[model samples]
Structure formats: structure tokens, C-alpha cells
Target chain A: MDKDTLLDCHRRISPHIHRTPVFSSRSLNRMAGADMVFKCENFQRGGSFKPRGAVNAILCLTEEQQEKGVVTHSSGNFAQALSLAAGRIGVQAYIVMPSNAPQVKKNAVMEYGGEIIECDPTLAARESEAARIVKETGATFIHPSNDMDVIVGQGTACLELLEEEQNLHYVVAPVGGGGLIAGTALAAYYFGKGCAVVGGEPIAVDDAYRSLKSGKIESNKTTDTIADGLKTQLGDKNFPILQKHVESIVRVTESEIIEAMRLIWERMKIVVEPSSAVALAAVLKEREKFENQKVGIILSGGNVDFRFKGRP
Target chain B: MDKDTLLDCHRRISPHIHRTPVFSSRSLNRMAGADMVFKCENFQRGGSFKPRGAVNAILCLTEEQQEKGVVTHSSGNFAQALSLAAGRIGVQAYIVMPSNAPQVKKNAVMEYGGEIIECDPTLAARESEAARIVKETGATFIHPSNDMDVIVGQGTACLELLEEEQNLHYVVAPVGGGGLIAGTALAAYYFGKGCAVVGGEPIAVDDAYRSLKSGKIESNKTTDTIADGLKTQLGDKNFPILQKHVESIVRVTESEIIEAMRLIWERMKIVVEPSSAVALAAVLKEREKFENQKVGIILSGGNVDFRFKGRP
Candidate 1:
């Protein structure tokens, strides 16, 4: 997608989303040995950047299409994002999740007024069910990351950061389904003076990191990372964007992500989930390289169940 | 004690402290059935509103007095606040704490350049130690909540909240040493258009509530509450201020505080300590009273040991 389309998508979704705040920490700056601005998408509507894409996709649809509604299959933030975004604009959202998905996740979707269709716990089952729903109800199936409108919409966050701090040397985001980082890369390419876009991913599921090297989509054999959000593989639509515009991917360990997450929670006084911490972990891991440089980090989301671990 | 002093304190301390953001939560508003604005002093410099008072008190000192330095005895947010505030003004801070105080609290004070003087864990021991330090070094003793300058400094948070939204019906804050609520009461009295200021206290340490009722200072029989910050009884200076301008104090159970804390952490994506949650808990307890009205809450601090509770 071009910058013009990205700008247009930002305009379309601007009225629906929060222009999330960019928070700076002197203590965190001392730790990272760099000047860093955190774009707190954890405070975004639906508690993640997922709503940026979900809202854009829904808004781009025709009146007839909106009435038919939209559908997506996910067991994470996107489920709530689609539900909340669709509900905001007077559209019905069909969220397809694994039957074994946690009750908290199901409850959040329900709270957002989404209709949940539970399928067997498999990728094939999820895709097939989504397809069946699209066929039966004439609902549009919006992929969590791969769609063009969604990617452009997700780019608006980086657009905002760049607009706020135009002199940023680099922009970083955690690579989940490649939506946030892909869009971020494009925003930096178009708006930044010479800013490079970096992706942070868990070493346990370094599909995006490997995919860039392989010049193709790569899958993880094991999803053993604590950052559960980054387990998904990169998509065909966003992979080319990432490969062409993105600079590199930084891999961090589970313990490192947790440590970074704790630092942000303690110092910044903000609650960010594990996925968001990966980007800060990447910065902390390579502190010397970023010394005295201005960097922007997208805190992807803050939607974790507090019952298992009292603070989210 | 008056609007002029509070306004002067705000002006003097504004350069040293953060004008922390006021955040609103739709989920919280829905739950309370009212419009609530949270003055996020949890995100304030030093991770609490203590610095507002600390900085103002230090700055109000004469040049010679500042040169002599300042001292306080505490094992909580005040210890760090004094250290950081004094450090910012290039003054020495003597922080006397019980030997049994948490090592993390000690480290934070040290990080802020406070010289820690270890004393016994008793209140008498703390006061005697602080007295001895002042007697020897001639350092000005600054009470955490009992001083005139400090009370005026603490009032600035409410001043800012009122300045931002002048039509608030009620302002609520967790009462520790009664400084924040007392200041809030004065600010509301002088600035708010018919605004009523309320204090929230832990049922475990309902000294302020009893003090207000009995028209005299009262001690807590047991500091059984999880809100460690509110364990202190109202001092002579702030108690009278609280009695005069404060409407009433609301007492919340431990479980209620935890529930309110969780709702904020879950929905607002902000980290607030149990003490900060007390105010919101009080509001939730009296939901009908605040229904359809505009309310402001001071989130006192975000300084909590997550290592013990995993997350707060």
C-alpha cells in the first residue's frame, strides 16, 4: 500500500480510535541509555492496536456490507477489537474462537457485544468455520493482520508518533501477526526523516525474524513463549512490506520480556501485556546501539487476565 | 490554608513536579453510573503525589535552611519523595527508616540520593531518631502530611483537576496522614463550584473517619489493612483542615479496595496502588450518591512492590 492510501485510512479511522499518548520516562531512559518515547497503544480502545485495523476494515466496507456484518477468527485481542469496533459503528461482529479458548477471552468478546462461534481447537477448523460463517451470513472475513485496509489503519499509530516527534531515529514494535510492525515500517518510510523500523519478537516464535531472512513466510514449530501474542506466523500481504521496508527484527527471551514488562509497569506506571514488552526488551538488549538516540516504541496492548497473575 | 498559598505552592512546585494527566474510564463510568475523572498522581514524579508536597515544602524553605538540608522519617512513598524532591533542588535529604523496612524501599531512597538512617520499627523510635537527626544537623524537619506548606502542595493536584474541569460535583482521595484529602477539601472549597471533597479510608485503619466523628485525633488499634500508606493517623495540622472543609470520610473493606484496584488496572490500563484504589472503592461503595454526577478522584500513588504480589 502507498502513503496516500495509508493517510486516507488514517483519516477514516481517526474519529473512531484514541490518539494514544506517548509517554517518556527518565528512569527508563537511564536504563535503556537512550531517549525513548513509548506510544501506549495498551491504552487504546479495546485495549490494543487491533482496533485500529478492525475499525478501518469495518469502516471501509459498504453500507450493505456493514449490515451483513464482519467476522474474524482469533483467541486474542483481535476478537475483542473486532467486537468493540463493530459495535461502535452499529455493525454486528462474528468472532470465531477455539472451543478451548479461555473463558475470560470469551467473556471479553461477549462484553463487547460480539457473537462468538466456537470451533474445534485447530487452525484448519478456525479457517473453515470462518469461511462457513462468511458463506452462510454473507459477512466479510477480516484477517487480523493481512488485509490492506487494516495494515494502513494500523500505520496511523506510527503516523501519530512521527507527527508528534518527527525527529525520531527509529521506531520499534512487537511483531505479532506482523500488522503493527508492518504498518509502522510503512509510516516511518513515508514520514520519518531517516527513521528505521525494527521488529521485536520472541525467540521461541521467531517466525518473522526467520521469514525476513528466508524471503518467505515461515512457521514456528513450537509456541512456547510467554509472549503468546507473537506466536502467529507472518502473512503473505504484510511479509513483502516488512521485507522491503523493515530494517531488522530483535529476538528476546521469555525472562527478558517479563523483566522489561515489569520495568515499564514499575517505572512508567502503565500496564502492558507481554507482547508489548518485547519491543522494550529489544531496546534494553541493545542499549549501547541506541545511546542518546531518539526511539519510539509501540506498546501493543494491555489485555491480560489478572486472575492468573494479579496485575495485567 | 488559603487559596493564595495553595496557588503559590502550585506555581513553585510546578517546575519541579509533573502536572500528571487526568484520565477517564468509560467502563468505570458505566460501573459507577457517573462521569469520573481520575487525576493520575500515580504517574506523578516519584510515582506518587508525595513529591508535590515534598517539593513545595523544600522550596518554601529559606536559602540558609535549604543549605542546612531537610529530614523526615518514613518507610513509604514519602521517603522516596523527599529524597527525589530534595535531590532535584540540590539539597541533602536525611531519610530515617525502620531497620525492618523493605530493602526495595531503601534502594529507591538511595537511588534518589537520600541518606538513610536506620532506626527501630516503633513510631516512637522513628520520631526520636528524626528529632535526634534534626537536633544534631539542624536540618529542617518536614512532616509527610502535617505541615502547612506540604498541605498546600498536596492541594495542587485537585487545583489542577478543578482547573481542567471546573464543574466537578465531588472530589475524592484516599486519606493517609490526611494531607491529600485536607488539601483537596481546601481546593474544592476555594475553587470548585459547590464541589464537596470526600476522604476514603481503609476500614482496618479508620482513624480519620473516627477522628472526624469524635472531633479529635484517634489512633488505629490495628494497622490490619493492606493499604500500608493509610496506616498513619491524621496529624494535628491536617486533621483540623479535614474536619473543617471535608464533607465526610468513606470506609471501605479490604476486599472492596482490591476489587476497585483490579477494575482500574484491568479497564484503565494504569497501575495504581491499593491506597489509590481506596478512593475509587469508596465511590463504588456509594455509587448511588455519585450517580449522574461529575466526580474527580486522586490516584495517590503507583509505588507498590509487585515482587511480593506479582502485580498490583
Candidate 2:
């Protein structure tokens, strides 16, 4: 997608999404030895940046498609996002979630006026359930991260970040289904002066890292990382954008992810999911490259089930 | 204390403290049945609003006193605040923390360059140790929440809140040792058009609530509340201000405190200590009083030792 596409997508979704604030901590800067600006999508609607894409995707649909409603298969932040976005837009959302999905996740979707269709805890079951819903209700199947509209919508986060921080030397984002990093790369490539885009991936599920090295989209052998959101493989639609605009993909271990997540929560005083911490983990893991430079990191989401095991 | 005292105190500490941002969530507004604004002292330096008072107290000290350094007997946020504030202002801080205080807290104090002198956890023991240190080193003993300078400094948070939310109908704060609520009451009295101040106290240690009715400072029989920061009783210094300007005091149960804390973490996506949640809990408990009215709540701090029981 081009600059106009991103701008138009942002304009369409602006009214529906929160223009979340950017946060920075001197202690975090000292730890990383760099001037860092964090775009906190953790505070975004549905507790993640997923709504940026979900809203834009739903809004871009044809009148007939909008009438038919939207459907998606996710047990994560995207389900809540799509549900909330659709509810706000006066469109019905059918979320096909695994029966084993957390009750909190189900409640969140239902709270946002989404109808949940439960299936077995497998990709095929989820896909089949979503397909059945689409066929039965004439619903538009909205991919969480692999669609053009979603990518353009997701890019708007980086677009807004760049608008506020014009001189950022590098922009970092977690590479999950590749929508966010791809969109981020495009935003940096077009809107930034010379900002480089980088992706942070879990070592356990290093599909994006392997894909970059192999010059093709690669699949993970196992999805065993603490960063649950980064387990999905890259898609063909966003892979080309990453290859063209992304500077590199950095892989962090599970412990590194937990450490980074804890540091952000403790130091920044904000709740962030482990997936979001991967970007900061990547930065701290390879501190030399970003030392003394202005870097921007996208804290993807904060939909974590945190239990304070202190006095209470 | 008056408006100018708070204004001047804010000016003095402005260079050393963070003018932490105000946060709100639509979901929270819906739950409380009021348009609520959260003065996020949780994001304040030292993870609490203590620094505002700590820095102001230190800056108000005489040149000779500053040279002699500062001492405080506490094992809470104030210790960290005093340590960090002193380190930033190039003054030595002698923190007389209880030997049983969390190791993490001690580490934080040391990281901020404070010299810690451990003592027995009892009140008398802490007092004697602090007194001995003051006699030995001539260090000024800064009370955590009972001094006039600290009261004025703490009032700056409410002052800043009022500055942003000019038409708030009421401002709520945790009672604690009475510094924050008393200062908040004073700020609302002077600066707000007609804003009333409210105090949120833990039901288990409802000394502040009882003191208001009895017209005397009262001590708690048992400090069994989950809101560890609010266990202390109101002090003589701040009791008069609370009686004069505070409209009412609302007590919340431990369950309510935990429920409120979880709501903030789950819906608002911010980490807040249980004491911080008490303000919001009070607001929710007294929802009918604040129905459709604009309310401001000062989230006291975010230093809770949170553990994520979810995956990773």
C-alpha cells in the first residue's frame, strides 16, 4: 500500500480508535542506553492495537458486505478488537473462538456485542467454524493480520507515531502474523525521513527471522514461546512489504521476553503482554546498534491476566 | 496552607518531579456512572506521588539542613521517593527502613543512592533509630506525610488535576496518613469553583473515617487491609485540613479494593497499587453521589508487586 492508502485508512478509523499516548522513562532509557519513545497501544481500545486494523477493515467493506456483518477466528486481542470495532460501527461480529479460550476473553468479546462461535482448539476447527458462520450468515471473513485493509489500518499507528516523533532513527515492532511490522515498515518507509523499521520475534517461533534469511515466507517448527501473539507465520500479502522495508528481525529467548515484560511493567508502570515486550527485548538484547540513537518501540498490547500476588 | 503555597511548592519541585499525565477510560466511566479523570501519580517518579512532597520538603530545607542531608523512617514509597529526590538534588538521604522491609525496596533505595540504616520494624524502634541518626549526623527528619511543606507539595497533585479538569464536581483521594487527601481537600477548597473533596479509606483500617466523626485523630486497632499504603492513621498536621475542607470519607472493603485494582489493570491497562485503587473504589461505591458528575481520582501509586499468572 501507498501513503495515501495509509492516510485514508487512518482517516476512516480515526474516529473509532483512540490516539493513544507515547510514553518514555528515564530509567528505561538508562537501561537500554538509548533515547526511546514507546507508542503505547497497550492503552488502546480492546487493550491492544488490533482495533486499528479491525475497524479499518470493517469500514472499508462494501455496503453489501457491511450489511452481511464480519467474522473472524481468534482467541486473542483481535477477537476483542473486531468485536468492539464492529459494535461501535453498528455491524454484527461473529467471532469463532476455541472452546478452551479463556473465559475472560469470551466475556470481553460478548461485552463488545460479538457473538462467539466455539470450536475445537485447533486451527482447522477455528477456520472451519469461521467458514461455516460466513456461509450461513453471508458474513465477510476479516483476516486478523493478512489483509490489505488491515495492513493499511495497522500502519496508521506508526504513522501517528512518526507524526509526533519526526526524528526517530528507527522504529521497532513485534512480528506476529506480520501485519504490524509490515504496516510499520511501510509507514516508516513513506512517512519517515530515513527511519529504519525492525521486527522483534521470539526465538521459539522465529518464522519471520527465518523467512528474511531464506528470502521466503517460513513456518515455525513449534510455537512454544511466552509471546503467544507472535506464534503465527508471515503471510504472502505482508511478506513482500517486510522484505522491502524492514531493516532486520531480531529473535529473543523466552527468558529475555519475560525479563523485558517485567522491566516494562516495573519501570514504565504500564501493563504489557509478553508479545509487546519482544520489541523492547530485541532492543536491549542488541543494545550496541541502538546505543545513543533515538528509537521508537510499539508496545503492541496489554491484554495480560496479571495477578498481583503481594498482600492481597 | 493556601493556593500560593501549593503553587510555589509545585514550581520548586517542577524541575525535579514529573507532572504525570491524567488518564481515563470509557469503560471505567461507564462502570462508575461518572465522567472520571484519573490523576496518575502511579506514573510519577518513584512510582508514587510521594516525590512531589519529598522533593518539595527537601527544597524547602535550609542550606545548612540540606548540607546535613535528610532522613526518614519508613519502608514504603516515601523512602524510595526521598532517596530518589535526594539523589537528583545532590543531597544525601539517610533512609531508616525496617530490617524486614522487602529486599527489592532496599535495592531501589540503594539504586537511587540513599544510605539505608535498617532497624526493627516496630514504630518505636524506627523512631529511635531515626532520632539517633538525626542526632549523630544532624540530618533533617522528613515525615512521610505529616509536614506542612509535604502537605502543600502533595496538594500540587490535586492542583494540577484541577488545572486540567476545571469543572470537576468532586475529587477523591486515598486517606492514608492524610497528607494526600488533606492537601487535595485544600486544593479543591482554594482552586476549584465548587469542587468537593472526598477521602477513600480501607474499611479494615478506617481511622480517617472514624476520626472525621469523632473530631480527633484516631489510630487503627488492626492494619489488616490489602491497601498496605493506607494502613497508617491520620496525623495531627493534616487532620485539621481534612476536617475543614473534605466533604466526606468513604470506606471500601478488601474485596472492593481488589476488584477496583483488577478493573484498572484489566480494562484501563495500567498497573496501580491497591491504595491507588481505593480512590476509584470509593467512587464506585458511592456511584449515586457522583452520577453523571465529573469526578477526579488521584491514583496514589503503582508499586504493587504484580505477578502474571497467565501463560508466561
| Per-residue accuracy of model 2 over B223-291 as CA lDDT, tens digit each | 898899999988889999888899999999998899899889887888899999999999999989999
User: Could you give candidate 2's per-residue lDDT for residues A232-297 as a string of tens digits?
Assistant: 988989999999999999999988898899889888889899999999999999999999999999
- Per-candidate count of clashing residue pairs (backbone under 3 Å): 0, 0
C-alpha positional error of residue A210 in candidate 1 after TM-score superposition, expressed in Å: 1.2
Misplaced by over 4 Å in model 1 are A308-312, B308-312
User: For candidate 1 chain B, which ten residues in a row score worst on lDDT?
Assistant: B303-312
For all candidates, state DockQ relative to the true structure: 0.57, 0.57
TM-score of chain A of 1: 0.97
lDDT (tens digit, per residue) of candidate 1 on A1-312: 677888888888888899999999999999888999999999999899999999999999999999999999999999999999999999999999999999989998999899999999999999999999999999999999998778888899999999999999999999989888889999999999999999999999999999999888999999988898888988988999999999999999888898899898899999999999999999999887788899999999998777623322
Question: CA lDDT of each candidate?
Answer: 0.92, 0.92
Q: How many backbone clashes does candidate 1 have?
A: 0
